[model samples]
Target chain A: MSVLVYTENWNGKFKKLSFELASYASRLAEMLNMDPIAVSIGQVDRDELEKLAGYGIKKMIAIENDALKQFDTQTYTKVIADIASRESAKLLVLANNNAGKSLAPRLSVRLKAAVASGVGQLPEKLSPFVIKKRVFSGNALAGLELRTETKIITLAQNSFDLIEKPADMVIEKAEADLAGIAPKTSIKDVQIQTGKLLLSDAEIVVSGGRGMKSPDNWGPIEELAGLLNGATACSRPVSDEGWRPHEEHTGQTGKIIAPNLYFAIGISGATQHLAGISASKYIVAINNDKDAPIFEAAQYGIVGDATKVLPKLVEALRKAKSA
Target chain B: MNILVCISQVPDTTTKVKFTDNNTRLDTTGIQWVINPWDELSLTRALELKDDASSGVAKVSVALVGPVSTEPTIRKALAIGADDAYRVDTEALDAYQVAAQLAEVVKAGSFDIILCGIESSDYNGSNVGGMLAEFLNYPSVSGISNLDVKDGQVQVSREIDGGKEMIALPTPFVGIVQKGIAKEPRIAAMRGIMMARKKPIQIVESAPVEPLSQTLAFEPPQPRPACNFIDPDNPEQLITLLQNEAKVI
Candidate 1:
């Protein structure tokens, strides 16, 4: 038996999550005393597939067909399940992102395996297969043990460390036929937001809350994030009020991010909002209320109006980064 | 269209999470319970579709896989505008078990559409909806923010990495919706609350299924370090601390 990692590609190039999944699968395989294999669907560069050798993948398989150019969850699941059955994969690893979250559950049901999504850490004990994950909006942790023979886990973004070790990786092309079934869903159109750091890969974030007052005041927030080479996020209320897109909302009902630094401007830090950002290494809260709950979680606090403090802080950071 | 919306009751967001029974069970003393925020949004959207004639939605049913303690929460949902309610007499064991139980209910009833939040607020497993689709052998679309129904088909918008993708599917599909699905939830009006008292609530026996995973214990996260207040007058000093002290710069 071996471990299988589903590597994702977008627009013919590999994503950062592809490397993270390879690294995670390699470590898990070492603990289970099994080889780690990567399965890729659709078009990905052969050289990019070969680069997985640096992450300790022993075998890589790429399945390519004209019909596979676009992502169809049903077709992808069928192909991956076939591969796992043929290889007798004991553990399946994927990133808990848009595609993985939708595919992992169906794969678990097809394979009759115990499934864990958004896993926060590696296995603590192999005998019982214990793992820990965040629960209650990151306020508490739950230690769960899988009871099934085979298990599927989707690792949270930025949760695990990537360790690289070169290995001799062999690439093989797989034969697949999609003539039997028809895909139910088809993508009619795609609108991609460009020139902004994705929340998943962002190392630093500058977020605003209701205290920012108006959507028109978002210029400084975006400017600050741009100056730091970071991403911009907002609280749930801001998104609900239509000040920002729901994709930029960072809270319990939104995206969970763990960056190196998180700047909370004019945020009061509700529990739901705190749950999504507890993983940040350092937190800085700038608000007018000294007793705001954000101060309890932040490492530094500045009690002032965001409109007055944000411009000065932006100018100062610009000078600091340039020098 | 017969739409089934799955929901769960969770501890209030402000309550401090604690454990009891040697850390195996969630501590309930003094904690207020409310309907999960994500599920609330789903219910609101389902009700909107049911009320609008052009949507072709005939009935909206709310289901909960929990004990009698959830009756009050279920009643609250009916008050908000569900045509009916279903309660499976069992505890929510895990994601797998929950999916199995809900799947059995969906199979027994003739439902054309199933709606649920992407994940619950407490466990955040994010697997039940997809698993249910697998059990029922139906197409599932998740992270959908917008939805429309026409001519027995569904058109949806789901979140992608840097953008959004629009998808189209036929009837008998599952959708795991998130926030942008609807506006803020509607509160239970006094008249609706009184009307909900007489609505039909069918209690069904839960399907027997063993849980695939067990929680061993609960632990609180490491406490944040002490905070140092910065002088707002000197913005440059804070920049210096970010570079020298935190070193994040």
Candidate 2:
């Protein structure tokens, strides 16, 4: 059979995670000698799904309906499970987004399969059912296997980079019956009531700590994060001190992330904090303390005051880009 | 409310995780154990419910399935304000097995509402709550940051990818509590400790339903490479380093 991937979106528009999931499913399908099929849902159109051909997807199947606009978990789960059953899909993949958060488990139950969430890589596919996934909130990797015939796994956001191929892939819409059931849950409104910070899927992350001193002075960090098209994160102390919302906290106790570039500003990293993002490709620590623990884990360290250094770095990037 | 709160005693978060001599087994000696930090949030919330319902009127019970070392952790829940506690005295630690234990306990109690940590601090698997829901055949909402109960139902708002998701579920459902639930957990006071003396801890011996796929030894990550300091003031030098030395940009 083939591998099935769930496409993701934000405000009815395709998101970066859709491409990443397609890429991951493509590779996993290759390793398993199976074809890759992406099931694009929500307000996404066929053209948007077909555009993911660059990720090496063989076919894009769109399931369109007005009720399918927002992320209603019951209807979404029903649609996915129904499609996977018809395809006899061996492995079902989903992006570890909020939609997948509730949908994955519900889909797993409907399909009667074992689910492995937060997966980081393809399985061994040999005698054992081994797949390496991040555990303990990305602190460590667990080598696990799914012995069940029908397997479902969710990919951690940004764990895999999509390769862009020039040739276009085929697109087809699937007319599926999700059956009749009143949705017990409702997504009332799409609230875009946050700042410029998009932590879950940002490529670059600029985080602050207790060193920022106060919330009023956080304007510079926010500006730098905005300029870089990155997100803002914080250490435990900052969240603990209420300088930033606890939702922004990234650590073993908070949300785990793995951005391409992580900028630690005025924060001394702790192991618990490092557990959340040690997978970041490049880490830059900007702390005045020469012996801060973050420096030990950081690829590049800046031993200077953040107040004096961050502004100049921002200015330098802007000037260098123009000149 | 028939509040059934599930907990697991894990190595304290601050512990320096070290492998044993063979680099296989985790170093067990002298490691302090506490309720998983996320699970502690569930305890805090459960206690709040108990206080709100006036104790015996609407009952609260703590359920855990782990080794006997978790007795104190169960007692800690009692001290924190659960009416009683139950610990499945088994050595199995697999996610499926643990979820089965919770399912059996849930089926027996017929809870109106259930609360559990989103994931275990030690296992970090984040599968138990979902697995329990799957086994017991019920709906579950996880990663809940703030929750309240009203009108024969519970309402919860969870931290989603870009924003927040709020859902309200009727009785007979599970909600996995997230860390930093509400605010910092309150300390166990002298009264809680005194009341815990009267609470009974019931231990049951039950066979594991099924073990999960094998898990390899815990491996502490390799130490990071040496840090290279650059002067942020010298943008030219930093840019060169990023391009040539680190090659991140």
Candidate 3:
């Protein structure tokens, strides 16, 4: 039996997430005393595939097909299930991102493998296979047990560190027969957001809430984010009131992010909002209310009017960068 | 055309989560139940489609896998203009079990369009819609932000890695929706609330499907250190602390 990891690529290039999955799978393979194998679908360069070797992935399978160019959950699940069965994979690991979330459940059904989504930690026990994951939107943690012969897990992003253990890797080409299979859905158009750091991929995030007072008062938030080379986000009410785009909303109902540094300006943190950013390494909150819930979760806080404090902080940051 | 929206009852967002029974179960004391926020938005979108005559949407129904205690939350969905509801008589143990149960409901009542929230706020499992589609052998679209149906054709815009992708699919598909499916969830009107009392809630026996995973225990997140308050009068000091102390900037 082998441990299999699915490495996802975008535009024929792998991201840091793929390396993280490889690192996770290598450690898991060690625990189970099994070989670690990675499967990369779509088009990726051979040199790029060699990068997995640094994370201890020795065997890699590449499946290139015109029909598999676009991501279809159903088709991808079928392909991965075939690989898992052929390799006799006892455990399958995937990143808990958009594509992974869409594919894991279907694969679970196809393989009849018990799935534990958003797992944050490695398993401490293998007899009954128990792991921990965030629950109640990060308000709490739940310990879960997988009671099946085969197991599948989706690792939460940024939860595991990428540890390099160099190894000699071999690439294998596999062809999937798609004669009678076809996707029921087709992509009519794709609009990729360009020239901006995506919130999910950012290390620092500057966010605001209703306390910013008006949509017109967003200049400081943008300026601060630009100076820090970070992304900008907002609370749900800010998006609901049209102060910011819905895509910028961060909460339990919206995007969940875990940046290295998060600035919550003029935002009184609600539980739902806190849930989204709880994974952040360090949180800094600025609010007029000293008792705002955001302060409780933040590592550093400034209790004053954001309108008075924001511009001054921006100027200070500008000067510091130049110094 | 017929539409079905799956709903789940969750603790109010403001309610503080607490565990009982040696951290094995959620404490229900003093807790207020409400419809999952994402499910509410999905139901709102379904009703909006039914409200339009040109869309040819004739009925909007809801389904839930819960016990009798969840009826109040199910009634709230009907009050918000769902024509009727189906309640599977059992507590949802896991995502697979819940999806299996919901598949039976969908098989019994033929629905052209099915809507499910991306994930429940309580468990944040994010598995049901895709698993349910697999159970019924139907196509499913995840991360749906906008959905429109015209002339019996279903089109949805889903959020991908950096942007959105517009997809066109036929009938009998599942849409796992997040925010932006509707501008905002609609509030129940007085007349709608009064009429909802007469609507029927069909209770089906739970299917004998075993759960794939089990929850061992629950615990609160580790508490953060106390906040170090920087003097607001000296705004530059905060930047210095961030640079020299926090080292984030």
Give me candidate 2's interface root-mean-square deviation: 3.0
Q: lDDT (0-100) at residue B122 of candidate 2?
A: 69
Whose TM-score is higher: candidate 1's or candidate 3's? 3
Misplaced by over 4 Å in model 2 are A109-112, A136-139, A165-168, A188-190, A194-198, A318-323, B21-24, B53-57, B151-153, B160-162, B204-208, B235-249
The collision pairs in model 3 are none
* Candidate 1 error regions (>4 Å): A196-204, A299-303, A319-323, B227-249
Q: For residues A1-323, could you state the per-residue lDDT of candidate 1 as single tens digits?
A: 99999988876677556777888999999999999999988788898899889999999989998777767777788888899988889999988876888899999989988887787678989889888888887888889898888999998766776779798999999976677867888888988877577674577899999989899988889998888888899998898888998778888767777777899998899888998888777899999999999999999989999878888889888888788
Q: Is candidate 1 or candidate 3 better by lDDT?
A: 3
DockQ head-to-head 1 vs 2, winner: 1
For model 1, which pairs clash? none
Looking at chain B only, the TM-scores across the models are 0.92, 0.89, 0.93
- What are the per-model numbers of colliding residue pairs? 0, 1, 0
Clashing pairs in 2: A136-B124
Model 1: per-residue Cα lDDT over B1-249, one tens digit each: 889999999987777888999988898999888888878888888888877788898999988899998899999999998989999899999988888999988988988889888888899888988889988888889888888876566788976656678998877889988767887789999999999999998898999898898898988877888889998888889888988998877
- Using lDDT as the measure, what is the rank order of every candidate, best first? 3, 1, 2
Q: Write the per-residue lDDT of candidate 3 for residues A1-323, one digit (tens) a residue.
A: 89999999888898877888999999999999999999999999999999999999979999999999888888888899999999999999998877888888898888888899888778968988988889999999998999988899998876788899998988999997676779888999988865356676577899999889999999999999889888899999999999998878888877777777899998999888998888887899999999999999999999999888888888888888898
